[model samples]
Target chain A: MELRQFCSQSRVVIVAGKGGVGKTTVTAALALAATRAGLSALICEVEGKSGLAAAFGSDALEYDELHLDDRLTARTLAPDDAMVDYLESHGMKRFSHRLAKSGALDVVATAVPGMKDILVLGKIKSLEQLPAADLIVVDAPAAGHAITFLLAAQGLLDAIRVGPIRKQATEVVEMLTDATRCQVMLVTLPEETPVNELIETAFAVEDRAGVALGPVVVNGCMAPLRDQPDSITSLMAAGFSLTTSTQAIEAVAFRSSRHAMQEIQIARLAEQLPLPQIHLPQLLTAAIGRAELNKLADAMAHQIELLQ
Target chain B: MTAFANLATTREIIVCCGTGGVGKTTTAAVLAIEAARRGRRAVVVTIDPAKRLADALGLDALSDEPKLIDQQTWNIFDRDPARSGLAQGTLSALMLDTKSTFDKLVHEHAPDEPAADRILDNRFYRNISGALGGTQEYMAMEKLHELHTSGEFDLIVIDTPPSRHALDFLDAPERLMRLLDNRMFRLLMMPTKTYLKLAGAALQALLRTVSRVVGREVVDDAIAFFQAFEGMEQGFRDRAAKVQELIDDPATAFVLVTTPRRDAVDEATYFAQRLESNGLQVAGLIVNRIHPEFGSESPESLRALAHGNAAILNLADFREIAIRERETLETLTARIPSDAVGYVPLLDEDVHNIATLATVATHLF
Candidate 1:
């Protein structure tokens, strides 16, 4: 598959996964990858604290959009701002003020089920309506709440049958379930627990949210020790006596073992999920920045070429 | 004794927390197993719905109730033939079922069966009670309170959800209380008829605006749900107070877990500093899955020796990761006491079963 074709399959790509799985990193890298493929991308951060801006070596993002590059832009979206936007756009600017003044918005957002989530989803819906960018990537909440976050639209539609909230939720649901409009990309580590959770989340999103699943982004895969024997004996036979340090031997063994385990998990994921996998190498750094992100985006672009 | 060993045996409540995918759940289970090995009855409550804990315990499934590990399962710790039956204490584990816990709370607080049903059957309540933000954290605390008061175990270790929001496990009660005590909530609690008749001019205007924007039905549902809880507010308030008290008790200990990743370390540090501001001490810091120092050889020398051999060069790569991780841990250990820190090097495989968990315990204890 061509990177541009894959990028254009869905206008909105929601990247979700367990915490610490590098969902934010994948979101930023995917946006960069799309932009590299000659498409303008807008990345939306819903949780506000995902460190998306930091991935670009910038400060914290606000509700206002920040253009990172010529073709890439990023912004943070909070529910309160979305609520005010939803009302003002609905010709209730005066009502938005009164509710904000009385502090009922907090009550409604907190006390009512799905109000906070719907407000945000409804805003995203309007963005799609405006065709904000050629591609919009949402750095969604972690896996635990992601199902509920995506299902908030359906939940509201069921709970409130006759209201502007219902009408907004209806449109959000349409945008979410339509494959051409939106698809969810779940990220996970090449480990047992994360892989287990990713498979479960993928199923739940498909069954409940009725959303399409894209290629699974497997992050943090150990670089393979290609064309080299894992055993010290083989290396000695090959005339490389290297130092006699036990730590060196242990390091080789440890890396080989973890790589083997990761391979097993990746195989298990494919057997179960039946989805194409994009493997990202584990960077030997404490945090990801622009350079590391570019490396990941390059890896993603390379994988997309071989995806079929 | 190691700081973790002391806490496992002495602390009545141990809260295991960390950023996502940092092995917090496994740490909690290991701590509970350690407590049980030390002859204390322990139960671990996991907020993550994944069945990893169940798989570790060799169980098909885990419910809301604590299920005891059979003696046969505990026998995995009896590795030495010289000493049999090493696990003298008992261990039980359960996954927190947030919805049922919330439903039980509603039933406990409501004045009668009909009143409870009135709230439970509400469309708004049915949807939000289980899946709302902050509800899982609140209910985890609620279950901790229930288990603590029952006196069934000497120690309770809980695995909180993975995120920076895990801090909410501590603040959910206060946040909920503030929400319930908000003037807006009180106004919403007014019966529809009474609210229309008695609402002040500003409130009336607010209500009209709310109806026009969100639709009258949602407002009706909100008013009806709050009205159903009119007499039950005191009960809920009192329970929240007790939960807060339990959180403040000296017997409760928070254990911070993290990986060598910089973000995870930063989150753990932030969580610890916040707890410090509240005068709560983190009993231990567990750094899971750290890469050990591979060798003393310089990468340049190794690359020269290998003549660009891929396998040997890969060893150099591994060495770099090990050093990078060591540096990350150095920064983390500086913030915590040397005695309070436990480091577990990267294991060969996932800690999926009791055998693997026992292997981790050797490093932790």
Candidate 2:
């Protein structure tokens, strides 16, 4: 499977996971990968996370898109701004501004359950319809809220009998369930809790939200140490200066066990989720910069190539 | 004693807050266990936890009420060398059941049984009680207040939701109060007939737009729900004020937890700043899963020793990670006192059982 083919398969790829699982990073990496594959990519985050913009060596993102590369762009979308945009695009321009000024958007957002999610999803739906970019990747909210976030459309359809809101939700649901239009890619660490939550979230999105899922991105995996001595004891028995220190032996022991634990979780994830896994190596850096982002993007491209 | 240990033992309330996947829940559990080891009756209220962590705390199917960790589980904690000679104390764990907590609050604040039942059975209430943006945070605070007033635990440790909205709870009570006080909310509280008759043109236009947007039916349901609680606003208001006061109480301390990752560190600093703006300060900082400094060997010396062996090269990678982590730790802890910062080394495995949690506590203390 070529990375370009994967990018073309879905107009929108929603990256979701538990917090700190690198969903934003993966979202950026996927966009970068798609752009490198010669596709125009737009990455959007809902939570106004500076990390997303910072990934591309930019400042904080506002509602307007910030051009990151020749084929890449990024922006943050808030529900209120999306709502205003939705209204103005729908020909209620003056009314929308007035509503925003009066702080009625907050009221309207809170007036109905799931209205906030619908507003954002509705904006994304319009974006998808436009074909302004070959790919649109959304950095969704964390897992717990993400279930409710993705399912808001269906939930709203059930709650509201008729109105523009219901119509908007119905459209959002259409975009979500259509496999070619949108697919959610959940990110997770190769750990127990996140893996469990990812499995649960994957099913809930598919079953309840009626959304399609793409390959799971397993972030922070430790690559296997190659050309190794058989064991820590054996390595220490070699009696090098570094090996003589107990901390070195301990470090090796720690890495081995951590690797073993990660392998176990990865196996468990494979057994349960049934999604192709794209393993991203753990970078030993204080922060993810442009260099690390390219490294992760290349890793993703390599994995996508390996996928059948 | 370390300031963290002292804070864990002495604080009446410790709220552990951080971004997700930073081990906020586990850190909360560990602090609770430590408090219990020091002979304080500590209870940890967690919003959601991993299955293994729930099982480890003997709360697999925990209800809204606090469930005490059995003596047998304490025996596991007692086995740790760090626990030797420590006075054994009681530990209880509670999982936050948001909807039920809201139900209890409605029952408590409602004017009468019929009113309570009316609000509880509202279609809108059923949806928003659990799914409202900050309902879980508000309910967590409500539950904490309930537990505090109960006098059942000497210390209460609460694990907040992920950082993006972790501080939402701080404003949740006020937000709730403002929501109740909003003019639209009051207008909606009116009977439909009265609302239409009295609403100004601006108000009418807004409602019309709202109806066109959300559907007339949801507005009706929302109105009915608010009408059901017409007389109970005072009660809810008073309760919200009390919760706010309790949160602002000097005895309630906040703990900022994070990993050494850039984003998590940024979130921690942001959380700390938010707390400071609220006239509160982080009592302690716990940095989890840090790669420890391996050895004194320099990369050049290690390379000479490695002589192209991949495993030896891997050891060099570990040293780089350790150094990067130490630098990151310094950047983070530079904002706070050294004694107030607890950096736990990367454990050999994920903490699934009590034994592993005990291991984390050893590093934390």
Candidate 3:
């Protein structure tokens, strides 16, 4: 279950989390890890959160892939853009033009309910179908919508029972259902609401789509309290004589509480799932780049080893 | 003049709205903190069901009513001597529980207990009220209107629910009115009990068939839920219309909040466009977690020094910091209108209390 082993087995790996939990950063890091391992990987982002582009040091990304390194590439899927491309590819250029002229593209796109989700999923499926790539890492929409997108094929299949749509929907469902082909990772912070939602989302996914539940990545985990209890007691005993010293002790105590909460939640989740759990330490700084990503990759790689 | 400074002069209410997890809570907190620091008594009310305001303000707990952060009490300003510069104007926060707010709205609108009970006791009312995205949004507006009418604060900042249905809250009043006004629905349910009596046998038969198919009592529960809401459409709709009018008013300003990330910005942009199309005034945009620029040394030099071959390094250790900062700034400048955009730098710690919120306020204002 090393990082390479997982990527080698799964064609489509979805990274999902609550917003601001650094799904995009983790997606980029995992993609970079895959590339570093000598696998050709395309990091696809659906949220239009050019986080992948930023992580790869690119100003912008188009529907077409931008090479970040020899084996790693990144692209963003804009639903409207993907729809137009999809229409053109299917030789429905006239219909596409007519829809554009009618100014009904937006209406049609949204009115169909799960249409955007379908297009986004369709695009990810297309990337997964690419011949050269060993893996396609999707930085999906936030947890809720991502789940909706993952289940869109089934939803459409149930809602529309006949025709080419049913056939396409069936294909999408098959792709998602096969664990060896597709896997979903729930990314979460070590907190009450996120952890609660993560567990709920896992159950929901299991019930609805029967998609394989991959490991959960708890992002922004704080380091364990390094200073001894005696030292802390001594500092407290020393009184609030110095503001800096007092603040230091309080900060450590606060950090410990946050970290402990995260660990407890992670353990609870691990007890429920058969999958490995990876803990990514909170960085001292807010901005994460290649350096922080590599450290996360190393941590993930270690988790993968444990899984094996 | 700052973008927000201009907004402050014109807008009455600033609604910071977005999907969940996009920093909508933090954005609202920072905006209120900034306004208060600028000598205005600003109140931030969050309608997100999951309470994060206390966490964002670094407080252990928050109440349904506005709570002043004790930390801000230490600062004093001489220029606004009428108000203690140190205490200045106060920044207050509260969390709006949507379901409770909706119930309160029902109680306010109904003429008597019997009438209110009739509506509340309806099964349809309970199920749809909680499940409908529009209901949550509308309740949020109702809460906003309550705060606006109070006149206790100069500015009221609201953190809207995280959903596209957030607009439904603004649009709820109209939808509710439409539903109430529907002659067809009323006509069908006119002999409510008689209709229930006649349909009960058929519904039972259908439920039995459904139970056989699904191996569950889902249909029976659903039927019971609908039967309960039979005669209360008008009361609910009338209140909904009133709430809708409050949201559509020109006095309210919608502030779209997003992170510097592309997906968030795009969603915010889409929301702003939708608000504008619906004739809702967009006060501005608050882009959070912007990468702060480091001095002098370029990304290229750092990249060259670190080299592509390096295995483990933090972003701060190499030129990726400069690169990311530049790219983020460029994206912000290109996508967000300069006049309506406010940037909050990335902080080392999560913004969970008054001091950090004040720090965020300084950056934003």
Candidate 4:
């Protein structure tokens, strides 16, 4: 219902956005929030993406989940590894090893569309089913693919009417569509492209999977530097020279215009996205690491409270 | 050091790539449009689903075929078009549709109609063609190859899929080769040969036993797919090799597009290494959406220069961003060693139309 409540209650929380829109950062922030809220969280990603690893500031992740802190574990999930685990869970451990060795797992991951996604989802679902983890936050693929991923099971179920694969698809679909079980959050930047794409993706997710679309997390928002009670133009007219300090005037002008543009886009995002939204202020640090993620988590908590 | 830095007259195949969300699509579009304004026929191939490319080009849609832009919009851009060494060029763009391109490839490359129908009609192809790993990247190259070989344009620009690693597009051909040449792959195809019937029987039996473990339908789907693709495998292999050659050609160049963010810079450096390691050419680097570099002096000096002029100088916010971004970009540029590095100031608004793209192209060219 509420932002913090949804973060705590949902079995699986997926964060999605366009490429380079800071989806991984938002996912890590959510994971941190979930951990802080006392919900043991497992942050999942499609393996080989170092974004999550960079966000968490740890390279220890592999098939086994690395415990980052109390109640928080992060792991990168690969389709191939998920296939191996799927086979092993299906009681074909030796077969999986042989398949992996022969590189058939690559074939499976490469050739099959929904198969790869299903395997990854199956793994996430398994982790979600675990009693040890209260919530699972999946850092999903960028917009187009993320929607395809969430609807992969439904696509298969629609295509294959009667089969074991269909049955598996049904279960994944159930988990995804159930509001109490899942919430898909669309992370965005207060920019035109990402916000527009997020709107399209939100509608597509609802149309295709009927999943509960969580609040929009607007990352990289530039808030006002300080409340300037008066305009610089007035001061310039009040006696400030324009030509000598052209660089400063230009930089200040650029910053003010950019901040003004962000506000317009933010308003556009609010009017366009049907779901609730939380704005995460832009980070000024040169690098993004755990400290930035924790700071974002704290900011996210404040926004959650504000929205409530 | 940048071979194709002067993209205006380079007259080469420019492939824009970098980590996702760093503006490859827009860069590719801008370059193509710049080429067009310079009087060459240029086409931009983009796989990004955002449709920003379409908007930037002032078009409602960009399909596989190169559609002419609205004359009114072109006229507006054409007014001061030659202001920046621009030629009287023409531009058109193609947004990639991998599924449609696959269908076209099937139509042209497949042995016969029924053979094409067999692969096309297969349920697996219906569901998986678009989603198949590397298909988008592979097909983008395939389409690029088709366009490059054609005598259509003076310049061709390709925007790669916004993958985490831009190398995925470059590696797609080799990876596709591996998938086709894998040991299990040959074993799976054994059943198609008449002379290998006995071995096929053995392998097929083992497959059935394996099928029971995973699922009959999935394994059967794989079997059916391989059977349908048997005739076309060689064609795919040949084209993949051709694309590999095309990428490594001297007339083709790769442009790394990135923002000034630390992650973008890190990935750009890593991407540069991957390109160099693979023996591909790095034409230049275009750092997109960077905060405007304030002044030639330090931020403190720049702020101090504003004495007596303002009650409040908001230069700190922008000055801080500008400095951090410059440092981050310097870290990447130092590693790249490409003198052709160009920085496009972060626009007040997103580059939405051809006019805005024209302004960006000024910085790039």
Specify the CAPRI tier of model 4.
Answer: acceptable
TM-score of each: 0.94, 0.94, 0.59, 0.90
Per-prediction share of native contacts kept = 0.56, 0.59, 0.05, 0.45
Show model 3 residue runs off by greater than 4 Å: A1-16, A22-186, A189-215, A219-303, A306-308, B5-10, B19-22, B37-41, B58-60, B65-88, B163-168, B175-187, B192-238, B295-335
lDDT of 3 by residue, B164-246 (tens): 55666656676545444433233334455765566566443433432332223333333343333444556666555665676
For model 3, state the Cα shift of residue B320 in Å: 4.7
Model 3: CAPRI class: incorrect
True contacts kept of 4: 0.45
TM-score of each candidate's B chain against the true B chain:
0.93, 0.93, 0.76, 0.86
Give the clashing residue pairs of candidate 4, or none: A240-B309, B36-B89, B37-B87, B38-B87, B39-B87, B39-B88, B39-B89, B40-B89
Candidate 3: DockQ? 0.07
Best by lDDT: 1
lDDT of 4 by residue, B177-228 (tens): 7766776656666655652564555455546545564456666676677777
Please give, for residues A1-308, the per-residue lDDT of candidate 4 as tens digits: 34457677678988888888888888888888877777778888774565677566677568888888788988878878888788788766757777788777765554445877887887777777774478888889877789888888877665555644556677888889888888898988887878788889999898877988878998988776454425545545645445424555565566567778888888998897767788898886667887888999898877887874
Local accuracy of candidate 1 as per-residue lDDT tens digits, B240-331: 98998988899999899999887888788888887888778888899998876666666667777777666677667767677777778888
The TM-score measured for candidate 3 stands at 0.59
- The model with the greater DockQ, 2 or 4, is 2
